[model samples]
Target: MWSGELLDLDAYLARIGYDGPVGEDGELRPDLGTLYAVHRAHTGAIAFENLDVLLGRPVELGVKALEDKLVHGRRGGYCYEQNSLLAAALERIGFEVSGRGARNRTRGDTLLAVTHAVLVVTVDGEPWLCDAGFGHQGPREPVPLARPGAEVVQGEWTYAVREEEEGILALSILREGIWRDLYAFSPQRYHPVDYVLLNHYSSTHPRSVFVARVIVQHPGDSVHHPVRRALVGRELNRLHADGRVERRSVEPDELLALLDREFGLRLSGRDAEELVRINRAGD
Candidate 1:
């Protein structure tokens, strides 16, 4: 049904080391479950970061661009880049996946516009939210699109759903049970160009975190590693095994090593040097 040649699911899965599937009920099974598997595989596999921005590269949405960046480059991506690649992977695996746009509530009024490129997948005739691009603080499992108050806790963060007007859904997380809006999304169909617009805003806007700072996220077996950089300096925080907080400052050169060693994002030595320079300047 797709116009382009379909992606190879096995190869894609193998590239990311995903082996999960869906069950007979059409829900995501342990081996090949669609939404659950996407979450499990994504958090377990791809990291969330803005290295492209730090490296002064453009983030594109075309399929080849995604494959080249994700599979070939072996790097992590933010929402549009990661989710777009994921949609292709889901489509290849025989799941009905569609692209959707969202507004980042965290940025509030500062951001020039909303962000695009999340996925909605159907499993057992039900829709589930599967996003792997929201960094370390995204949903750990596929959440039901229609279920309000549904929650999933990953490490210290807990994701919950709330319904809003106009058929929109707000995804929130309890940072100590206080609801924080992650983003508001609708199950609307979006063209790749729609994502291009949002991508441009995120990458170019003055107030955007993408342009203003460096963001990194890598997930472990039971913890999440997140770091942020701004004029105030860089902050490195870890979501520990027992859900404790740990914060520290890492050297700029060390940041590159952390990305590769801890987060599994490999960069060339030149890229690493550039990242260190940019991060140092931001400090």
Candidate 2:
């Protein structure tokens, strides 16, 4: 159950740089074409980031907070925040949408917890997988859910969905000439409270990776995307989309400037200083 009236659809579309056709009544066009356009625009405009977690700032999953931070503040967020915002916008636009949780299997063989969030949207009676949260490796468009082994290609990227078990689906991406499992999930629908718990564990748990370092990611320009990971006051690793990565030592003095310039983060002097201090302490 979503409070659709609370979401400003126009603001969300504007924030994502989507200028697609809104109906005469000022509602978003509820069709597959519009969904693809919106998904691409969202992935391109908004970024996948976790700066707040690293800075010890509370990551609120509520709709109003998401609108303020991601839309008005011109900031980026991780999976929960990103997908949650997208889901709300879709619901407001009259699309049938539901939240699904998945285990992030990109790292290794071990089955991780259900820490990722994705959206399953039905357009014209067919279900499509729409995810705007997964940084560079994310799909730029919706993938058909009916086809068991369908490959969806967007620009230079290629993704696939395969049936892993009776009701489980495995999403994989082509990386280095290999198909890698990105995540796996069932058809079980999740609620806002479920994501709240996941977000809490991710943002606050000691073993959670979000607290260990600063990870800022944005869809790249043309042929090159960038993922900036910093150990604050130590080293900053910039991974490019062209497979060329550059690593450089970072001093505390230059952290603020780096975040502002490279990650497009708008931070006050006090906020910057506090983030730098936190990163140095490795808390």
Best candidate per TM-score, number? 2
Quote each prediction's TM-score.
Answer: 0.83, 0.89
CA lDDT, candidate 2, residue 20: 66
- Per-residue lDDT of model 2, residues 56-153, tens digit only: 88899888899999999989899999988988888887889888999899888786888899989999899999888876667767889899787777
- Provide the RMSD of all predictions against the true structure, rounded to 1 decimal: 4.1, 2.7
Q: Candidate 2: global Cα-lDDT?
A: 0.79
Off by over 4 Å in 2: 24-26, 221-251
Q: Against the unseen true structure, what C-alpha lDDT does each candidate score?
A: 0.69, 0.79
